[model samples]
Target: MAGLTKDTPYPTEIKLHQKSRILDITFSDGKTFQFPCEFLRVYSPSAEVSGHGPGQEVLQTGKKMVSIVKIEPVGNYAIQLNFTDGHNTGLYSWDLLYNFGLNQDKMWQRYLQRMDEAGASREPASRASTAQHSCK
Candidate 1:
């Protein structure tokens, strides 16, 4: 919502691969990006995840298996991604998407660093092995 401009490259194609848990998107400028569901969920631009301002970002954990259940277009500027985890507030604009595609690697590294610093794991807690237990 902050970066969309008149020159922003709009999406030409968008495909969701359920089995692979990837969103493959192609922009009007011939750039294609494959966005993993977990990455998207962790990096969601919604206020709930990104917070209302700087230094208020909430670190998302246990979302490695999250998936996009639906995609809805918002007029001509953006699209809303409905995640399987019930998150659906972020309006991913063309500019934001393009920037994400271009900076994914750097952003991903930053995310990993943050996660490590916070001692967080991306694996969902519900999926943790039942083999480990404490004696009563």
Candidate 2:
């Protein structure tokens, strides 16, 4: 697979819009993307977020209040996201972010379907009983 290069930096700028719940990412090459907070939340690369396998995927709800706490670089390939809700384990690679940028529509549609099936909304975790099985 082809990896990203300095000449192809993933994004030149990333802005977190608190009120809009959207992350605005501008690629160095002039590509721009706007990802919703819920979208970024559900598609988080953490195993705590993505689960282990296809069928084991988890639906993240109640993230309307969530915010990006930090963005830590991971070498030349990826970055780790620290969310305000204290759930930070995802390492979003350049390729993954790029793909997510490209496939936002389809992935979000699927996420919505899963949320509907689970009768879940992107709300904050309130009850301990709401805890589901881990992907491990």
Instruction: Name the best candidate (by TM-score).
Output: 1
lDDT of 1 by residue, 39-67 (tens): 88888989999999988899998787799
lDDT of each: 0.86, 0.74
Q: For this target, which candidate reaches the highest lDDT against the unseen true structure?
A: 1
TM-score of each: 0.90, 0.78
lDDT of 2 by residue, 1-136 (tens): 3566565557778788877778888776677889876677778988877788777766687765678877788886777877887877888777677778878889878887777688766556673246543211
- Over all chains combined, what TM-score does candidate 2 have? 0.78
Q: In angstroms, how far off is 15's CA in candidate 1?
A: 0.4
